[model samples]
Target: MSLLLDGVTVGYRGRPVFEGLTLPPVPAGSLVSVVGPNAVGKSTLLRSIAGLLPVAGRVELTGESLTAMPRPERVRRLGYLPQTLPQAVPLVAYETVFSACRSALGSWTNADTEAAIEAVFDRLGIRHLALRRLSEMSGGQRQMVGLAQVLVRRTPLLLLDEPTSALDLRWQLNVLSAVREAADAQGAIALVASHDLNLALRFCDQLLVLTPSGRIAMGAPEVILTPELLASAYGIEARIERCSRGHPIVLADQALSTG
Candidate 1:
């Protein structure tokens, strides 16, 4: 397993969000989805794995303690795509992609960087926009470029925060498929925080659901996304139906409250 959180407790500014958050180590080359209502500390758990947030409990990647590694080294080993990516400085699309490779391939040559950048663009279906400026692209294109960074970085562990939040429907499907392909193709572990339960059900193999206020309901989606769990966490009735594939299609039972 490349990712392990052993009794990890996380918070922001001394306010604990989740305590004693523990899960069995996940096997590599699998996609793990984190789903919960807002403010549930899903992002907090991801940030901790990315080493951007402090963890009260142990966090290990590839059997190495996150605290034991320096920032650059850890970043080199892990790719983090936060929800809000900074605006590119009017750089051409290809240039921006090339810049991301500096961390992975080093500062030697922009030649190799340029080649890999184009390859990523081709693989991601964005090669046509290579000459365009960052400010000119639509929201979804910008999101794709932001995602291209983590791809060009080519790290073994990817932590994505609501990766499809800014994308439209087609782009959303493309981006999620790309995420799965990238992770499995390279044998890297990926953890994604998503609000779209249906999308997660379609794409991910495992799940770690959080409470509305932030605590672990740690298990597979089938085990954790029951009517009882949904009633308690979201105060709504939930029906989990199985299609022919055995994957659950969740429907919110609208009889929420009001006697």
Candidate 2:
């Protein structure tokens, strides 16, 4: 399975942010990180691929055009977590996640839904929050609940927009680890949009870099995340080094003079 983008064009107000952009096919069972400076089209790209935004070219999954699929079928095939978390309603955390899976299945029984919800909650280590009302939870707790909702859907294509934004350091690693495990276990294609360079490099298998000009570069993180590329993309002088554990770490020493 693969997700392919061919000549994709997206914009707002009739002004093109990126035109005729084509990406290499992202293989299934892989976790890829989409990284770029703020205001680049990273989120837009995910939204366009999720069929939330109108796009000009083709977005395909496993040789089938995603846009041509019915709305429900499309929904069943892809899971999208937006940058903004949902508003706190008078709903419990488990109920929200269970409802997401129920909606996807359309006619699943309560027993089945409960079983699925429990499995997801356990996987995310949020079983304790099962009965907690959304209104009573903190922002980070709510964010984790939102992630559980997405994970319960079991969609083959997962688009996560800053899923770790509201999370603490521990939950950041936990969420990314769970996502990677899901992709590996289910053969899903996961694209995560994040601002944390080290996190992306550490957890993701492939890096899709959205340059400041809306151009893209794709490869292993170590190869693609050079000082020159960092300077060009972020206007920073960065040093890519290995920590004590021998993992790559990017140290940005100074901001470049772009003017």
Candidate 3:
């Protein structure tokens, strides 16, 4: 299974963020990070793929046109977590995740649903927070709950917008690791929009870079995370160095003057 975007165009009020944006098919079991500076359309790209925004061209998944699929079918095949955190409701974490699971998988029996919920909570290491009310949880805890809500759905395609933005360093690693594990276990395709290049390089199989000037780059981290790409996309004079574990890391030595 794979996702293909062909000549896709998206914009707001006739002002195009990107036009004719196409990419090689993103295969199942691959976790891709969409990275760019602020306002470079990372969120817009995810929203477009999630069918939350109007688009001009083809978005197909395993030969099925996602743009033309029925709403329920689309919902079943894809799960999206927005940049904004879930609202601080009076509901407990378990209740919030349960509602999301039931809403997405209505045919699942209660026992199966609870099992799935428990599995996700365990995977996220949030079992302790399950009974805690959302209003009582910190922003990071609530963010984990939001992710659990999406993860419990078990959709084939996951579009996560800044999934770890509010997380601490350890939790960020945990969240991305969980996401990567889920994608590999289920043969799912996960497109994560992140500002943290080091984390993306470490966890993602591929990187989709969006430059401020509307350029797009997609490849393995080693192939795509170059000094030139960094200078152009982020306006930073950065060096790419391999970590002790051989993972690529970006070191921003200086910021280029935009003026």
Candidate 4:
């Protein structure tokens, strides 16, 4: 199970944001994080692969073309969570999640649906809020609920854009852990777009760094998260170190003086 992007180009209107972009095929059950500075087309890349944007390239999953698939079929195969959370609806968390599940697969037995929703809420540690209304939940809570909607789909390809932007420290770690577990246990491909370098380095199996020059660096976190690359892509002086647990950590020392 490999996700392929061959010579993909995407942009707004007639302007090209990224051109001739190609990423190495990632195997099944891998979590890949896309990291870079603001407005560097990180989100655009995910949107393109999610089939939300028109692009000139081939996006394939398991040797099948995702770009040419039908919309309903594509929805069942690809799950995308955008950066912005949805506006508060009048329904409870359970209802919201149920609606998402219904939309994803069209039809299901009532028992199966209820069990699936409960399982997802339990995995996300949000089962306590299952009865709460979305209008009453906090931003972070709503974000987790939104995640439940996506993960419940159990798609082959998962594209998340800034999934942890609204969460606190604990939830941030929780969300990534759930994503990692989903990929590992379900044999899915998870691609995340994140601004947090530390979380990406800690949880993601592979890192793709989108540079300011529109170039990309793809490899393991330790190999890609270098001082030179950080300085070039983010304009910050950073040091790579290992914590007491032996996990890699990126420490930003200072900002480089840009002329």
How far residue 210's Cα lies from its native spot in candidate 1, in Å, is 0.4
Best by lDDT: 3
TM-scores of all candidate predictions against the true structure: 0.91, 0.97, 0.98, 0.98
Question: What tens-digit string does per-residue lDDT give for candidate 1 at 66-128?
Answer: 867888788788888888854855787877777777855585487777777877788788888
lDDT of each: 0.80, 0.91, 0.94, 0.91
RMSD of each: 2.2, 1.0, 0.8, 0.9
Comparing 1 and 4 by TM-score, which wins? 4
Q: Taking the tens digit of each residue's C-alpha lDDT, what string does model 4 give over 45-87?
A: 9999989999898899999888899998899998999988966
Worst 10 residues of 3 by lDDT: 97-106
lDDT of 3 by residue, 45-81 (tens): 9999999999999999999999899888898999999
Which ranges in model 1 have alpha carbons more than 4 Å from their true place?
107-111, 213-215, 243-247
The all-Cα superposition gives candidate 2 an RMSD in Å to the true structure of 1.0
What value of lDDT does candidate 3 attain over all alpha carbons? 0.94
- By TM-score, the better pick of 1 and 2 is 2
CA lDDT, candidate 3, residue 23: 99
